[model samples]
Target: MTQATNDQFLLAARPVGMPKDSDWQRATPALAELADGEVRVKILYISLDPAMRGWMNDARSYVRPVAIGEVMRAGGVGVVVESKSPKFAVGAHVMGVMGVQRYWQGPAEDKGAMLAQVDPAIAPLPAWLNALGMPGMTAYFGLIEVGQPKAGETVVVSGAAGAVGMTVGQVAKHLGCRVVGIAGGEDKCRFVVEELGFDACIDYKAGPVHAGLKQHCPQGVDVYFDNVGGEILDAVLTRINMKARIVICGAISQYNATEAVKGPANYLALLVNRARMEGMLVTDYAARYPEGVATLARWMKEGSFKNREHIVEGFETFPSTLNMLFKGENLGKLVLKVADA
Candidate 1:
């Protein structure tokens, strides 16, 4: 056994709109030794999500903001190399909010509370943290608890081809709802419908979303799973059926707004239709995560749930890989490979 050190990506500055290269700093330091009830892990993959943008700002949120100069907060998969804990043995593969680094040192209690041992047989290590992970849970609870879709109803999801939105549509279809997705491009729209099993997919970049929705969802939307708010939210609002439910998941469209978030101009439709719209934080359903994970894993095994990942090659690409979310360059869950182990 020998001592080792690692490199980490640290937050340097908060961005006003879109994050830039200067907003991040890379630093190397000696890895700390494992203490009592602690373990040292070699991080393998880091999850890149839209919510990471909100974490960069200094403001009140469901979770604390990532402080300046700290290693940027992220979820990742890792292999334990050293363990002084009874629960986790060396060579174990686990997933947690491990930050953007090549190595992690934390108490076994901390890992036990926030992390889970991964089964590579269920799906790949990265897929568990992506499709079967937080994004999957977000889609599951957001639709079931918040949107409340019913059979024969029309369900619409914005940001349709992305991680959460894509999962939402697929789940809706599985529950016997007619699913329509709103994505940015034709290729993504094709993947959403042809690959992910949505009934229809609208290309927001190609034409008017309002018209597209009208064409696909002529019967009116029963459950609206909104992942990209702003104009698309307003457009969906106009088409809600009476007693429709709107699940306010993530609003990737407004995440980087330099200006104040604008309210939906068509909210009056909610009043007229007596529809309900509510925001949700996945952590709010923490107690029921195992239930969700069990169902998701079953779906994955049965070939009902599809897990997609767009993985970058190295830890050094963390900052740039994150920007891909805002640019709509990724087709599925985005992950950064930090190390080989």
Candidate 2:
């Protein structure tokens, strides 16, 4: 076969607030031949997540910051075109931390790469990046393991129309809980309620979240799966049930703040309610990904769950496409399609 040219976006600089095109340096590097235990993959879809903004910061966090000149960190689904590893064969479809690139060439057991083969028959390739990918795992584990909602309880999820929030509400509904979503705009709220089958979705842009919660979650929130923190978290804290569980999944609202990230001002409510708030990193449950994948995929197949993706085509649209997340422009999971399966 002829040699492949790899186009990738490297971290050029860390931004103080929202990242811009200047923060990334695009480069086309010559692909190297696959060595033993290595494979070359043609990345198909790259996941656009809110957590990516945090990764661009220089400060310490769950994972190290994306180093300058290194490939911008991202999770993607791809197809293996060449393989020198027994674990992966040629023509296999896989997903991993392939980054904002056209291809991923790496060792089979590279922990940072986190490579794994995926089946399209189970769900479409983009769905693998949505419901069967990191976002789904984040929603499943964050809600089930951290939020710990019981049947007949009230569960509230911020960023309700986004990837993690959508899955969190759906999973809560499947477990027989009353699910309420908090999102911006009327259309997103409608999608969360009508399309995703949430009990109700509060349009934060239209009115106060506290009023919405009082109207929809009359019983008080037993479990709150927080994705977009800040004011929304403070609003939910005021209405949490006694001994409630609050899951800190992501804080998209504060990710692009130029100043210090805002903390929930109503945190004292947690103490008054005897509630607990805990943060979760999806990678923390990597060993049990199969459990989350199996459960979510089965629900998808059984017609009880649905996965949606807003795919922006083109390899060069990564920067603008990524900004869509913070702008509340995309419905469901936002992904960038670089190649066909």
Listed in order, each prediction's TM-score against the native is: 0.97, 0.98
Who wins the lDDT comparison? 2
- For all candidates in order, the CA lDDT equals 0.88, 0.93
Give me the runs in candidate 2 sitting further than 4 Å from their true place. none
What are the per-residue Cα lDDT tens digits for candidate 2 across 1-341?
73568899999998877788899899999999889999998999999999999899888999999999999999999999899999999889999998999989989889988899999999999998898999999999999999989999999999998999989999999999999999999989999999999999999999999999999999999999999889999999999999999999988999999988899999998889999999999988989999999999999999999999999999999998999999989989999999887
lDDT of 1 at 38: 88
Give lDDT: candidate 2, residue 28. Answer: 94
What lDDT tens digits, residue by residue, belong to model 1 across residues 1-341?
Answer: 63577788899999989999999998898887778998887889888999999999999998889999998888988888899998789989888888888887889779333867887877789887776789989999999999889999999999888889888988898899999999999889999988889999999999989999899999999999999889999999999999999999878989989999978999999999999999998988878888988888888889988888888897777778899999899988888887776
Instruction: Report the Cα lDDT for residue 302, model 1.
Output: 92
| Candidate whose TM-score is highest | 2
Q: Per-residue lDDT for 271 in model 1? A: 94
The window of 10 residues in a row where model 2 has the poorest summed lDDT is 1-10
